[model samples]
Target: MTNREKYNQAFIETLEITADQLGDDLTYQSIEAWDSVGHMQLVSALEDAFDIMMDTDDIIDLSSYPLGIEILKKYDVEFS
Candidate 1:
């Protein structure tokens, strides 16, 4: 799968949501499934999917879908 797909899957599987629910509007605490625990799970999933260890600051900074992409970029994960 592509990096984008891996990213989406991290959110989808971690949050127990469907791919159709993924979007730029997706943000932490925006859904019942994305609470504090879910946030850590999503962070773990992203780390596993991208094979990168994110700093605590980045994990905390990843509050939105668009921002996640930016944070991943800091680790050299390219979407395209």
Candidate 2:
């Protein structure tokens, strides 16, 4: 699967959110399901999906969907 597909699947499965609800603007505080526990789940899901280990900085800085994409790119995950 593509990066976008992987990202979407991870977000959907971990966040329990629909495709329409996901976007670069999506933030932890923006959704009821994206609490602290869900944040950790999201981090784990992203790591598992991308097969990349994230640093504490990346984990803490991944505050939004766009930021997540940016951080993942640092791990060599091409968005395209």
Index of the highest-TM-score prediction: 1
TM-score of model 2 (CA atoms): 0.95
Q: Model 2: per-residue lDDT, tens digit, 1-80? A: 89989998989999998999888779977898888999999999999999988999888998998888889989999998
Clashes of 2: 0
Where's the lowest-lDDT run of ten residues in candidate 2? Answer: 24-33
Against the hidden reference, what TM-scores do the models get? 0.96, 0.95
Candidate 1 per-residue lDDT over residues 1-80, each given as its tens digit = 99999999899899999988888889999999999999999999999998999999999999998899999999999988
Extract clashing residue pairs from model 1: none
Q: How close to the true structure is residue 64 of candidate 2, measured as C-alpha lDDT?
A: 91
Query: Residue 64 in model 2: shift from native, Å?
Result: 0.6
Scored by Cα lDDT, where does model 2 land?
0.90
C-alpha RMSD between model 1 and the true structure: 0.7
**lDDT to native, each model:** 0.93, 0.90
lDDT of 1 at 40: 94
